[model samples]
Structure formats: C-alpha cells, structure tokens
Target: MTGIRIELSRRERAILRAVAAGRGVLVSSCEPALTIDGCWCDHAAVHNLVEAGLIEKERQVPYGLATPAVITRAGEAALAEDPRST
Candidate 1:
C-alpha cells in the first residue's frame, strides 16, 4: 500500500468531510448517495483529492452513473487531522 498524503483547502476539506459523514445515505430506492443543499454530490471536487491520493472513485452498481468518489484511508486521516471538523 502506498503512503498517501492529501492536502486540502479549507472549503474542499469541509466538503469532503461532510460527504464522508453523509456516506451511505440513501439516494434512491436501490442506491446510496450523499446530498448537499438538495444537490446530489457527484463529488467533482474529489478530483483534487484523487490527485492527492486521498480517495478513490468507482462506478455505481446496477446503474453505472458517474464514478462516485469515496474516502480512502488517507482521507480519513486527513479528516481526523482537521480540528475544525465535527
């Protein structure tokens, strides 16, 4: 396993943390997703996280929507290090 280090800006960090907290929240009758202000998170900001190696993306099951970004172990570490998160 690679030792990944992800650096996030203030807003990006918060958004990712929120998304992490909102994970597995049901988005539909058969799938799970997260929402922000009634906006289903396609998690485009995750591109930065991905470059930093903080998270990974995968295609949705059954429907094959855009790759949903998910927190990697490194991402959890980053979130934990953020004292502002709660």
Candidate 2:
C-alpha cells in the first residue's frame, strides 16, 4: 500500500467500515447515521482517498454539494484488506 498513505486512526477505520456497509449508490450523508460517526468527513480522508484512487467526486450542477464522493473499486479493495471491513 505504498501509494496508499496514512496509518489510519481508529475512528477513520470505523468510517471506512461504514462506507463498506453502505448499499445502493453508496450515497452517504454528510451527517453519519446509526452505523457511522458523523465527524469522519474530514478533508484528510477525502484527500487521501482521492490520491489513492479509491473514490471519486462528481461536480453536481444544479444539485446538492458540487463535490461528493462515491466509493470506487479501489475503495472496496482497500476495505477488503481488513477482515473487519468485510
């Protein structure tokens, strides 16, 4: 996981778990729900995941937040690295 940086904090790992459990289009809320802790939407995670090619952000026109990310294959693969995530 060379290009994949960061030694994830405990809370960060939990957030990743929440993403994994997300179904449908994985449209997670900015505010975490029952299974997720809301505070995890930090810039650090978004930057790192983007750098690692594990997620993507779409520029929304006439919609909600201009840049919201949906998980990618790399993200699922990254999550698969931890058994707790799967």
Candidate 3:
C-alpha cells in the first residue's frame, strides 16, 4: 500500500465492489463508458476510481473496445476498510 488514504462515495464504493467481483469494465471510445454485468454504471464514479488508482483496465484493447477492470492493491485496501466489510 502507498499509505495514501482514498475517500470514496457510496456510489464509488459500490462500483469498486462490483469491479472486485469481476463484473466491471471500461469501454474506451469517444466517451469512455463504465459497465457492470453488461449494464451501464456511473461514468464519473469510474473515472474517480481510475484516477485514484483504485482500479484499472486489465489489458489494452482497440479504441472502441473494452477490457476487464481489475482492482488495484489500493482498491483491495479500500474494500477492506469498508464499514460493511467488518
């Protein structure tokens, strides 16, 4: 862990949980899209997670394609800290 604490909103936390469950992806296009189980999720929240280094794309794909989202070490740490995780 980087020892940096990241704060997440309820929505972001849910999104991260979904990603951690192998149900999230980022579709790269003119407007990037975040999806969970083939359904749309909060784009801004996904952006926030990515920016915070909590999650990332599993691999590079074509411009209009998508890749699986993987939780980072920081992401796991954040989930561990979730109040509901106790």
Candidate 4:
C-alpha cells in the first residue's frame, strides 16, 4: 500500500485554517469565521477535504437540514506539516 501525499491548495488551506481556529471542528459549509480577503470556503473545497480523509462529516437535521464536519487526526497532522495552513 502506498501513502497519500497531502498538498493543500490556497482555498483548502483557508478552510483548514478556519476549522483549526474553531478548535478543530465546525459545521460544513458554515460561514467561515476566518477568511482570506473576505473569501469564505465553498462546498467543493469541503467535499475535497472529506474525500481526502482530512475531515469527517456527520448527518444532522438541525433546522431540518445540515451536516457538520470535524477535522480528523490526519487533518491535524496535515495542518501541522503544511506551514501555509496555520
């Protein structure tokens, strides 16, 4: 088996930074508390993170529809390694 190489894009890094600052967890697609030049994270970026096993999404029915996400251990490690993520 091979290992996955984590390369974070500028957008992805922004998302991770937001999550990390929120104590490593927050609602997916929620308005970012942190943004770069007022640019918040998008759905595609969240989906990409989920697919990469860097974030975990759980089903929730808050106000009838929503799913929250939390950063995974791998995600924390990734952020630690990627200086841009901080």
Q: How are the candidates ranked when ordered by TM-score, highest leading?
A: 3, 4, 1, 2
Off by over 4 Å in 1: 1-7, 22-45, 59-64
Q: Write the per-residue lDDT of candidate 4 for residues 4-45, one digit (tens) a residue.
A: 559988888777766655433334344322222344457677
Candidate 3 weakest lDDT stretch, 10 residues: 25-34
Clash number by candidate, in order: 0, 0, 0, 0
- Winning model by lDDT: 3
Q: What would the per-residue lDDT of candidate 3 be over residues 5-83, giving only the tens digit for each residue? A: 6778889998899999999988877655789999998878877888888888898898989999889999999988777
What TM-score does candidate 4 get on C-alpha atoms? 0.61
Give the Å shift of residue 66 in candidate 2: 3.8
Full-model lDDT for every candidate: 0.56, 0.49, 0.85, 0.60
Candidate 1: tens digits of C-alpha lDDT, residues 1-86: 35444456776686677656544222322333445445665555644655566655443444434444567777788887767655
**Higher-scoring candidate on TM-score, 1 or 2:** 1
Worst 10 residues of 2 by lDDT: 31-40
Worst lDDT run of 10 residues, candidate 4, spans 28-37
Which of the numbered candidates is closest to the native, going by highest TM-score?
A: 3
After superposition, which runs of candidate 4 have C-alpha atoms over 4 Å from their true positions? 1-3, 23-40, 58-64
What's the lDDT for residue 81 in model 1?
73
The per-residue C-alpha lDDT of model 1 at residue 8 equals 68
Model 2: how far residue 16 lies from native, Å: 2.8
* Comparing 1 and 3 on TM-score, the stronger one: 3
On residues 1-86, what C-alpha lDDT tens digit does candidate 2 reach at each position?
45553445554555555555552122234532222333335556555655666655433333233333456676676776655543
Return the lDDT, model 1, position 39. 65
